[model samples]
Target: MKRFATLMLAFALVLGAISGAQAATIKAKGQWAFDFSWLDSGDFTSQDDDGNSDDDFSASQRFRTQVDVIASEALKGVVFFEVGTTVWGRTDGALGTDGKSVEVRRSYIDWIVPNTDVKVRMGLQGLSLPGAVAPSSMVFDDDVAGLTVSYAINDNVGVTALWARPVDASGNEGSDNNTYDEVDMFALVVPVTLDGFKITPYGAYASVGKDANFTGVTNGGAEFLSGMLSMTEFANGAIDSSSSTYDAWWGGAAFEMTYFAPFSLKMDAVYGSKTADDDAESAERSGWIVAALAEYKLDMVTPGILAWYGSGEDDDLDNGSERMPSVSPTGWGVTSFGYPGSVYRQDTYFGLNGAGTWAVGLQLADISFMENLSHVFRLVYMKGTNDADVIKNNAGVRDAFTPGNTYVFLTDEDSAIEVNFDTTYKIYENLSLVVEMGWIKLDMDEDTWADQDFSDAKKLVFNFVYDF
Candidate 1:
């Protein structure tokens, strides 16, 4: 903590000095936002299946702001900060768990190469693969120190590359599982466009070293590699200094099309593999997922469909592959709504690890109902693709194993149906009101598991977002 403060101080000082030297020209613009709204909080685990059985009708507030800096037309910087709040379902205290209400979410500088279509960014930055727009994504989604570069090949083609050291061996952050000397990550992506559609393919590689993960290594380790292991997912389950560094790789494709006029489509397909670095474990864990969405516009409304399939593990815990493992770092990326069915709201459901699952849903959206209003409604259904029993360890971050993670207790089989609705109302050029609702019911359960039946789940959330 002390080191973080000192580093921030140095950063401010350097920026101040630069401002003094370039006193002539600097451009800046940023957004200041405040939101307030009421919500329906559900206590599914509280034994009530009735909708809105326990609820409050009062509003809540949350705040956020961001600023961008442009210097010399070739150099730029940005900073983003936000505060927490109480809302539907739960409260993390308006004052965050760390007793700090404000956090620096992003801070970075961009430098453009002279006379070329190349730019480089260094400092606290965010990295992600092609599926970043989804509510959830796999590896390297958080903000961290790294170097990212991009080059434009033409109007519809471009390439990007990044290298980042997410964890240092010296932090002692995960003392109990400290088994990495350094965690390094690298990735590259390219986009090719045709007249009607564009396709983007990306790949990433990560490797860890077990050398400086132990005691008595003061000057040899790095610091502040917080939660980097989640990047490799459960594959890094228990860190052991005696084991070799874990290694993994993933590749995927993202494509979008709008050539069909009022029709549009987007899709992502990814595959990943993790090798057991130490001889103690004689097998590898791998998974794959495919998600896609297509919407067509008409005079009054637009209709769409979304579908996804994630592989699951077979009974062969020692060898057979196909478990659609998800590498969730903070469990925030599962933003893509599965439509007809998803166990929980976030990422992964009942059969994420072993014997994968599949979901499909239909969506209806339109903006012609009112002056500045838009609505989206959806219905979905999901279930496990294979009947292989669930794994005890890597069942996703949200729907974790029971008597194990202590964060959640859900031993699920498969089968579910979901209905959801979201509406946005624009109040002014810089203000809007948004509301979202969902209802979920489990269609299947683990007949053999004791007291594992899940209650029906539902939620309603709405907030106003105005900025100046």
Candidate 2:
């Protein structure tokens, strides 16, 4: 009798498992990209270990896949994984090809409130503030573990709020770990739409603990934060570091007008500030940025003019930096080689945001003479807005300010011109081949670089992409 009862229980459990599996649907999609590229940085001083020059040509590939389990339109869970960029002939992708490169890029769940219009997304996910620009946001654009909630009040208005913890040093067990060793941010955005126009205004605030370990943060968080702190009292004078925290805030608005078909205009403006909790005069930094683009779409091509300017550093380091502070800017400009133009597998400048500069460009995009083939041409002139006195008067600031990607850091007398001609041809509905060529002529001030010869930067790339 006891054996009979055990068998019956096992059968019931199997039926329940089958019922649950039938209630949810599974879906999957992903992309694969392979690249053959050559890049000449034009910096003669660059060398690898053993005092050897690094190679400029390489082949690499990346793959990403996302799986979704959905019960309904408003309820689903997603898990995204990536085998990140792996260079050919490297240990990871060589003959053995046994590299442990697989990473969980994102994991999240989306659900709506019962009988309500409010929706919530919770987990490690991508977060980007609204911007009129095509590629990315300047202030904050990255993936972090966070909770986001959104609601649509009507057809013309909506709101979104988010809370994210980008860094949490409390997980470590050491002197650097403390109760306040973490960074948290809160933000809200209100979007309004009317006919052919739309605008989104946003505000965000962050609390940075004094002992927070920025080195663990990705996308150049440590570099930018340390650079800004160098201009403040904490780095130059005696201050009670244990009792102080940093407060950072940003406000911005993005606008777009497309009421007139075939012609459109877009603009983005933002201001940012950071200060110590004690409000030290030497610990305050603030700046602003404005950018605009106007484009007219023709039958064969779309011509556009883009321009942007950002406040740069003044001569007084003791008064703090005048240049704007950013979280993680993607640095998408007219060309991929000069700036971190929006491209797959080529976003090499992981954390260097292009602040303290100005630029103007003319773009001819979507230039296609044949089906399934397209081309883009861009010419950009860029210069720095920072006063040269900051580097001239300060000692060691020049070398310390140089990040991994040294192409975009310019001074008042420094300038560069970039040109890009890229082409793409679709082989199938989900496969394409692309070739990109780029060049930049640098004009560095002799007095600043101390007679060092700066060569022109060049790039040639071939990419094969497949998506589903």
Candidate 3:
């Protein structure tokens, strides 16, 4: 990976050299950041759920920059680099001490088809698949290396597609494992706008050629339980972890309407599924996810209602029901270990593909209080759709590296409640300060964990960011 990064940087420099013949332009952007937090039982604490002791606070500081080069009307390129070890998950890279965690974040070039409305982008980059997209970082956000194409259908519509690889297998076969081919992906997205409403619909199809190393279906950030179940099957000694390949797909429509100005609605819903190669595991990979937000705007405040649900693995494996599963590259990323972009904050225990779960919440945002200053608050109620959870158990057994203070603290409880608020102040057009805090408590179904005592968690964070 280091070699590839170096090569890409060298290639971009050469491209810029040749562009001097035309009107070439180069620009750089940079950001410095800091985040400090009071430790909780969540990550840093005096005592862990497993009763271990730790620090009561944490802090992170970093700087990042990106260089943009426009060689011509049809050609452009970008180089991104960052230095820092971050616990806040705001950025992606290796953890470092003594100031050595610096790494390349993105290196991609964009090429436009001459005299046409089409363009092609290749290399390491981030791409957004627009549609009824949820805000869950582990489900909707994706950054990858590969090729992407975008063509304008018209002023109101456009189409985009991708061909990428999420996982690479080195062809090393062992007694229980065979190095498999890389996981390949193909996706198509169409965005359209009519009247005051904008809607994006997308469909994605991905597969693994051979071997069973492709784990998007069973072990992506959202659906870690699927692969876990296959492990529990180990007791039966019938299913080897690498014994099967799978195909998975996602399609959905995202809705947004602003014609009403003060009154608007936003929604994104998708159905995802996974199946054993050749339909061998007929009982797995079926689910749907939906989230909708409606708000009424006032002179200085906005009040909104939020609702969401993501299907989980069914207790009856043979039952004809679908659960939502995210692609491997989706989320903060196995590659980047990045930060959360939605309400499914990384500090929280909720996994996007927990299968049978739902939430209803209220949002109150105040923007009129001051210039460059705003406050947003949310109160949410979360619950399960199933009577009992099988995926949680399966994931519990399969997850060996996760810390007990982290995922293990998540119970079979059927419900939870969380309240959070964020206050932001823009010190300058390019600098901002934010303070975000939250309190989360577990709510359980009497039938699932009748006597278990789950502790509540809270967090207070301070962030300062400067851009240049």
Candidate 4:
């Protein structure tokens, strides 16, 4: 009751301030989306060896809405607030019961400096890397109380600096594990444009609290309880006795150029390092992915292809030693399922993901047939190389790695292919309908784990969006 009263009081104050302000423009925007999906088999396969099939057909539906409010010059300084909520249930195990549960996604105040190209922003906001890799889809909004400053050196070159305290370490989220007090992140970005070419060089540093260790172990055919017992040792080894701090830094550059009219190329690369603050234990991890894309505008159609490679880090299998292992959710041939924040990592803390190894893949997206109707269509495909040692080990049974251990598990190296078709059509002036179909194939030489023969999987999804 007290919390509700406080909220009501706050809303009243906002309304009163708006009413008393001088005549000035205020702007507001909102979006509401509903997504539905049906899976041929919800059971993707588990590490348990109970011989019980985990694959089962299932479907889900979800509704998400976001609202943004901006108070213009009437308030002297611009104040913005954004909130999001889930309005429906999803069959996927990830989403919880939903009915207007609102969360603040962004709330900040921008103070403009008269004639200079400088502004100071404070309050909870989003921190994003300049590159597309770390965009909203991959890394959700990191709620932090921070300050940002930007300067326009010239028409072509601009710079920005930011510092923030991550919400996780700020005790704002209310977690029992509060051993680490705070996290500090800083980044610098400089963008320049010359003729038809543009380049941006960026650098970022972050000091993350390290109270736990990251470990990954395979259960082989063992039950979940047995696998947990065997994996305890690896988890215990990743902890540092001293200050318990993990320091990480990353730097990268991106370039885009247009050689011919209507045709352009894009590429980006990043390198990163993670080490303990006290130096009692340290590991060097770095990888770079490069992609080249070409696009030609044909009225309303745009198509492009991309090729990329990453040297993923190896897992630390032995104390003070590391082995090249495939990471989960994104390593080898696995693609993460579920939406942002709800997604789960195979191994949360300890894994061989920090060791530098290599992976190559390609992707293609095209927009076809958009005319007369308010609809657009798109298609995408991707593939990558797999690690032999990582796949052969089969999660733990030593015998599984022997020459006779020819049983190929679901993690075995094989070509993975995914095909997707999506379309969106306007139903009204502010509402639209979306439909999508996706198919995945894993061409394996032999089946080792699930007695069932290996083949392919398919899924279908639909969505409706309303904009205001």
Candidate 5:
């Protein structure tokens, strides 16, 4: 903690000196949050960690700040720093508080062409694929080193192009001889707006070297891709060791309609496919997913319905998975227990992806019956689309479907229901307090899971936040 403070002071002094010597303007924004939480049956299992149950109770805090140095309207440099999801009494939050926990979340620059309307962003930055019906996304969404070029053709039309390198193992051991140990991606998006309707269509492509280091990826992507690469049940090895590369592609469109006052509708549909060089029949996977949301705004609240469906694995493993592949999924769910997009400063268990499942939900948001206070309530039910035999008939795949992972692999006979209630109170212009309650009832067919049993999950959270 002391080191962090000293570093911050030195950084501020350097910035102040630079500002004094230049005409650039300096601006800053940040957030500080603390949370207290209680959770039970989070993993839906009875496993204990060194005699302690999987359930948890704890307090944690986080801090983030972004600074921008602007030379003019056309050029600027930005840097964002983050510290901790540090739990009380843990490493960085312990009595001495001497842990090294600072991270550079983003460092980028924005510039525009001198005589054209073209804009460019370069460096480490946050990026997301276009999607409707949620603040997060089911496809790629995270901070990555990349370059983006955008042009506004007119008020109603625009286009953007991007290129990113998610993994590069150029100098690593065993990588010197192989130039194919990297992953590169490219994408394009076109957005159109007319009247009260809007839509965005996008397409993305990636080249994955056979020896690509998935560890360099973030947001649960590493695990998902690693799982796909290691499935050995298929004939002659799912993804042959001799395969040189894999090609992956995705196409999607997001639509929004607000032509009718107080009523709004949003939808997204996407398809993705990945194929390995070797013709191992099961070396390829392809599928699709669609999601929609509808809401009606009233004087007291906004009532909404949300739904989604995604292709899942079929009965035959030899044909590979029918489920859609995602690089980094951050889908928002209606209920906190199922998706937890609405919760603040609280760690959640459910994987944000809606892949391999179908769900329906209803929510009442912005329910305010008292001054300075508001509430939101949601209920959702979900069922898996994958065949039960995918796991029941293959014992080798069971270890990969454990509860320790970020996302759960469910079969056709698996279902779950989730409920969430959230309350918020504005204590000051820049500070607020929030409380969240959530529960989930998970059911897995006994016939398919055999001796495996899962318990219900519940959680309660309280948070204090300040923004500047």
Candidate 6:
């Protein structure tokens, strides 16, 4: 706490001194937000049996605050600072044990170039891929010290290049002791406009430290190095290794077009691949996701339809191969709507999602009822093909166990019907009260182990903001 205070004080002093010399204008912005949620469950455990466990209930709360300062034209620079904290929680083991603590979320600076379409930004900043909605399989939101440069090639096209570190070290549970030095990121984004429609195409690559061991054996094992150099020997030996690092790359193209007739459309396709180092006996895996959304605007309501399809890697047994795993939400990635246990990854040669596979859904209405109040209602359903069971038992028996001692199971046919309602009212020009209610039902085949039932989850939030 003292360290944080001291850092803030020092930053303020530096800013004051710089501004006083140049007679620059000083602008400040701040925001505060609070969120609370309640949950009701019936047999929420990930176990396979419909055990008559107790019907449990729990609630949690969170708070966040941020401040930013911008220098005047004379100084030609911008500075930002953010801090957030979770106030209460009992649903998760980590949060339930030790309470929350406040910590710095972001601090960054930017300097505008004197001429041309170029600017340099350094310090902590947010990173996102080029997509309307991030894939549930890919992680989102990394904060790192980096720089970005933008250039306007012409009236219709622009490009941006960026480099940053991989770190999401916010003051949250599981964030302590998180460190990475050999990991780096780079990206290129290009936007072109034509006939009132914009097309964005981007690509990004990350090279992380070597942490994945593909040999199926640890360094202490005699067969470890042998497994890496020769897959034939690896197949014959008993291999077990710790997690290591490697390089991962992703690229995508997207189009957003709007006609003057009150309708807009968005579509995107992305491909991701991971390359392991020599010590890791793992094979290169690749996957892709395609999504499309169309929306029509009415006087008081908007309606939209969304469709998404994701393909997993093919299984190759001869190469000591397995299907590529879906990405997990370790930090601020995609979150489950109301599922009981944390949904990590899905296995399939093609069509796998954190929620499910090959989802075709529609949202009927998003309406504004009264002044400063609105409502959103959506109905979406997903289906899985070559499904994979996510639950694991103590004995390591799965829906389908591979000869290599890997568990690759499939879920029976499953579906979820969800309805969400949200309302917001302004308390002042910059403050508001927000409330959301969600009801979900999971339907699965009788033999499946999931808690196939219906339930309601509620969230209430209040926020105050002064934007510059």
Residue 146 CA displacement from its true place in model 3, Å: 1.5
lDDT of 1 by residue, 1-468 (tens): 999999999999999998775763444444443333322323324334434354435444456566666666688787777664434234554344333456676788888999887999988766666652243344335566689999989998999998877656565756545546666778899978899988889988777665533235332121212122222233334344446676768888888888997888888788876565775242455677788878899987898887777765454444524543333333222222322122223323332221256777887878457789888787877676544254433345324333223222222365667677777788897777767676666644454233455556566655566666
Give per-residue CA lDDT, model 3, range 134-238, as digits (tens).
433224445567899999888899999898776565556663344445567788988898988998888987765444444443224233233222323322322
Candidate 2, superposed: residue stretches over 4 Å from native: 1-11, 42-54, 172-177, 217-243, 280-283, 331-334, 348-354, 403-407
TM-score against truth, every candidate? 0.75, 0.91, 0.79, 0.67, 0.90, 0.68
Best by TM-score: 2
lDDT of each: 0.57, 0.76, 0.61, 0.44, 0.78, 0.47
Q: For model 4, where is the 10-residue window of minimal lDDT?
A: 221-230
Candidate 4: stretches off by over 4 Å: 1-24, 46-100, 132-143, 168-179, 212-243, 280-284, 314-386, 390-414, 443-455
Candidate 2 C-alpha lDDT tens digits along 397-446: 65544334233457898887888898999999999998889877877777
What's model 5's TM-score?
Answer: 0.90
Clashing pairs in 2: none
The whole-model C-alpha lDDT of candidate 2 against the native structure comes to: 0.76
Q: Report residue 98 deviation for candidate 6 (angstroms).
A: 14
For candidate 5, the 10 contiguous residues with the lowest summed lDDT are 230-239
Clashes of each: 22, 0, 13, 13, 0, 18
Q: After superposition, how far is residue 213 of candidate 1 from its true place, in Å?
A: 10
Worst 10 residues of 1 by lDDT: 219-228
lDDT string, candidate 5, 291-330, tens digits: 9989998988999998989888887777767877666654
Alpha-carbon RMSD, each predicted model: 8.0, 3.2, 7.2, 8.8, 5.8, 9.7
The order of the candidates by TM-score, greatest first, is: 2, 5, 3, 1, 6, 4
Return the TM-score for candidate 2, rounded to 2 decimals. Answer: 0.91
